[model samples]
Target: MNKTNSTKKTSKVGIVGGGVAGSTIALRLAEIGVEVVLFEEGASLVNGPPICHLHAGGNLYREISDQQCVDLLKQSIDTLRVFPHTANIRPTVIAVPKRDKGEPDALLSRLELLRNTYHSLIESDANNKVLGEPSDYFKLYDQDTLIELASRDFPSTPSSLDDWMIPVAKNLNLDEFKYPLVLVQEYGLSVFRIAATASLALSQMSHCKVLTTAKVNHLEQCESTSQWNVHYQQFDSTLGDWVTGYEHVDYLINACGYKTGTLDNLAKLPRERMVEFKAAYVTHWEHSQGTWPEVIFHGERGTPNGMAQLTPYPDGYFQLHGMTEDITLFPKGLVSSTAANAQPELSAPFIKKLTQHWQQDEVDLRSARAINHMAQFIPEFSSATIGGKPLFGAQQIPGTDPSLRAVDISFDGINYARTEIVKASSALSAADAVVDKLQKLQLITNDQHTSLELSFPITRSLTLEQVENFAEQLAEQRHYPSALARRVAF
Candidate 1:
């Protein structure tokens, strides 16, 4: 490690992990002239677990509380304002399957609550109306209306809700689900776009140093200076060996996603958290030529018949997630940190999938199961074949509860904060919480341009065309179809 004392005084914040949590904080802090150093073990940022849906209203997860859904709505709006280019601008369809105990009417109260909350947010700030008009935040269509829509032709570009619903009505087995299919303004979020945008923006920022493909080996706090020394190693291509280095900063943030507990263990801060390993499989439906909204068939999680999600991508690609033990979730996927070690250790098989390559047979098996899960509702979807490798990774949920969705930053001390974001949309709120902490510590001023303005200097420097190009490039680089970087309808 380089023990250079020259740059110690200027280093303000050091972030470990280049996931959305760490990337958002680095971008937000750097926007206000704060010096930041972000470390990512991966080659790129925001390459963690797949973040397909924006979760604008948390309608997908029926187990979560109404308050959590409301919080998700607000946080998702904040995310949209900052990264407008990432929004897919397509609505989501939430349906209760006949096999499930949930009634469609039971969801009406929560949808109404979300709509009212959305209206209130828009009333407070007109800019919060990114998910379309507040009045159209959600729409309900009875079985009869859907049956009528099935007879209509699917448009190439959907101009109205009925046009978007036509594909769902034609493809989906309406008899298998209850009446009143709810279409919400919840949009899709492109993880590739976020990765491209954050990587580009951070590269251009003078005050922020983005260290990709660098692994943090150790962390030590200086007793006298009250600063953190983040020790990391990067591979030197010329030397064909790893080079070690360290950065000293006044504040530290452990945004390591599932591995956050590793730093807490190193700091000897025994914190309670859970890590879950989840995967979403990609499939290509050649027969489906029309644009379809994101479809959700509600079922009890962890059961044989679990919630099946079919998220559409451009060019016949769709991501499927079956919330059963043998599919997207595993037998011991959710693990809690022990008292001795804050880092909850996943089994070798799960770790292998995360760090190393997943076995071809396992991918094929799980993906087939996911396809069948979706085929339960859309019988024609049984023919869909595997499109690409599964988007898989582990995520850190702050508490022991696996269902917790809404979370922000939690501070261990005045200078140390840990990000525990369950959903990607919560990343901006976690970043704002870090900013608030900095303000409280008198490190960053109150008037330091903290607002999430659409015209931020760094984001404004790039156009939507540039974002599209970079996002497609990232998707291709990651071995995924470039079409996955695009919106379904728009």
Candidate 2:
């Protein structure tokens, strides 16, 4: 390893992880004239990745309980509105296609429960009038109408609340899959675009210093100065060697994703550290048309493992993702270390069960039985396996009369809803908190042209060759072009 030095500063920032959270903090702080040193273990911003509006993740609808967490999320959403790439974020459709009538009812109840998380969107809900499934989608369509609607082709946008929500015709895949489809309008994000746009926006600001090749060693605060010393590793691509260094900053923000949390002797932080493990698969197919929305399908054949997300791309590719609470990914009693293959006592079986869950093993189906068998076998992940929120009758009938009851509501999560909105909101809020800390320390003055305008120039266009080179530079240098780079290109 080699040694390097950055100009010592008391107020500099060293952010680890190049994902959405890290980038958002870097960009926002840099815009405010804070010298930020973003160190990513990855090559680029989206290089790890995600946006969309509304609550994109399942847990976001759940209670955070922590006031600071809620504040972070609120600030995150507000900050997202200003980014140019957010304009590309469109509304998403979460469809609950239930094989049984009771399933739809349970789905609505779950949504109603989610509504209880927020106060503004209250309603009478008489006769299930305003269930708040985006213009009361489930309420508007009855069993007969939904059954009839499902008999035809996927319907067009209906004459409903066209502002925030749009209702979809239940006739999607009519003959092949004849389930009552109850869809609500939510927002979906293309985080890659957000990352790309963020990188480009970062290029416009000269104050921020981003380093992609660095790896953080640890965090330590000096007792005397209260200054933070951020130790990291860097590779000299020229010499093909690694170097170690440190950045002394007055304040520290840990955007290091899941790896930062620690309890006793564990690979990552504790469960309450707000960490999760989400998996997704990408598939491509022929499509005769575009304009399809990202969909969350529950109580359907395709989603045998919890819930599945089908996010379609205009480029003809769709991604399938599975979301769950991550209390299991990190096992307690396991010491955190840099060694790759070395693991704790339960790591082997835990990873086995976890991977099987993601693969949806045909033999075991990655179900409760499989999980139980693993729990009995290993017992290490026993407590870890039990952290997800209950969907309340999500899997089966409540009591007797399985035919009369509906399955509980289900949703897919990508490790605590790592969408552009969630990431932006949470990250920006954290940035604001850091700024508050800096203000307490008097590191920055009141104002210095902080109002930065984010624009995607319409006049800028690059050739195919330039596009390829630009793309490479983006991944290598971790810089993206302005969001409008593709909007009005000639």
Candidate 3:
């Protein structure tokens, strides 16, 4: 273990975990001149194993709006352009049309309409820059045209919109119509890589320090200075276990990702208040000659078992991720164990089913090749799980679904809660330390009806429920309001 000292008076940010959330926040904070220290249990970016094999081309979707998606696409393009190796991460999308067994002509007409609509959307200024010279990569092949070229051909599969659109597709506007290759090219190889690079880029600009192999054991509040004292252990192959202590500004941020449960220990909240969800991945093959499909199937077939993603990665690799359900799949030590035993069984049958449907549509499967297989779990409904298990659904508030839970906390005496909120920090002495900052800053004010309102333009796509759950997680961690304060008018 090695020790370094910094007596700088700037706000010190200690970020736990070096994954996407942690690294991104650390880099952002560092860019703003804050003194930041990033701690990762694993090796830092250079020495760490590849985060994941999956490529996240759905960058256009996620939780944002169409306009926001466009903006994010542009941002992602600009960010990737700076890195030489990122050329492979450019954008590519392939559209596949599905037809009911008896409605071939109807499917063809729908395909044409979809193609036209997609072309219009892609041609729009919102997409022009990202699509580049449209003629270069954007070309359409009629179903008949594609079928004639294939050695084996069949009709398109039965397709429906209700199930496909309601959840994931609706979120991205892909549910509105069926089309091929909405926007496909190459992008980053994995969500983790994109996140890691973003973090590294941010770190380089901000002068923030990152310490790998450092796991925080606990945190303590200093009554004298009202600062946070952190106790952590650093591991090294050359050196034995080295325990160390450090102090940071009163504010702390928890971007721990799935390990968010760790925050419960450092704060006043019970572990049951958070919920964990799992997302499993399996790898398989398709022929390389066939172009990658643009439409991400969202329904049971698209997602598989109500909780999976069958996405195509670059270089003929496809990642078939299982459903997002309870975190039980991620029980202790399972992540590593699963990754080590990569097998076709984990995702083959699911991919086979998807491809079978594609084959009915006369799509070629031999074009894809499998390079690897893996699985992962994401902690969702974080405000509603305890000890890695979910709380009873009966305890859920009427309007708030337990599946989407949230937390809210307010000081007892304050007319308006104003405070700097920090999570997983040892700095909180009283509620005011977290809540008073917002109140004093006029971020939150007393109102008879609602507790808070936004005074500035805050752009986000999270639903009210998701926001509430996020806020609850912040509160559970003893952080002030997890989100910006909004004044509820009387």
Q: Write the per-residue lDDT of candidate 3 for residues 1-490, one digit (tens) a residue.
A: 0011212234465666665445544543443344667777755431111222212222222222333233233333333322222223233333332321121232233334433433554565343333344333233334343333343322232122212112222222332224432333324333323333443355445356777778787876666754566677887567665767565644555444434435434643222222222222223332322323323322222222222233433333443333222211222212211222211122343234322322322111111111111121111111111111011100101111223211222222222111111111111122213333433533333232211111101111123333334333432342222211111100
Kindly list the per-residue Cα lDDT of model 1 for residues 1-490, writing each as its tens digit: 1113213325489999999889999998786677899999988898889899999999998889999999999999999898988888889998898878999898899999999999999899888888888788889999999999999887878988888889889988788888789999899999998888898898898879999889988878878876888899998878989999999888999999999999887766778999999999989999886888899889999998999898999889999999999899999998999888888889999999998889999999999999999998899999999999999899888777888999988999548999999899998998889878887876656442335783256865767778889999999999988988875655
Error in Å for residue 165 of model 2: 11
- Candidate structures ordered by lDDT, highest first: 1, 2, 3
Per-candidate TM vs. native?
0.96, 0.58, 0.46
Q: Score candidate 2 by TM-score against the native.
A: 0.58
Per-candidate clash tally: 0, 18, 60
RMSD for each of the candidates = 3.6, 12.9, 17.2
Question: With candidate 3 superimposed using the best TM-score fit, by how many Å does residue 367's alpha carbon deviate from the native?
Answer: 19
- Candidate 2 lDDT, 95-136, residue by residue in tens: 443342224344455544444432232343122212234334
Candidate 3 wrong stretches, greater than 4 Å: 1-9, 45-128, 131-192, 195-206, 223-226, 269-287, 290-295, 301-310, 313-315, 322-490
| Model 3 TM-score relative to the real fold | 0.46
Off by over 4 Å in 1: 1-11, 448-450
Order the numbered candidates by TM-score, best leading: 1, 2, 3
lDDT of 2 at 394: 9
Residue pairs whose backbone atoms clash in candidate 1:
none
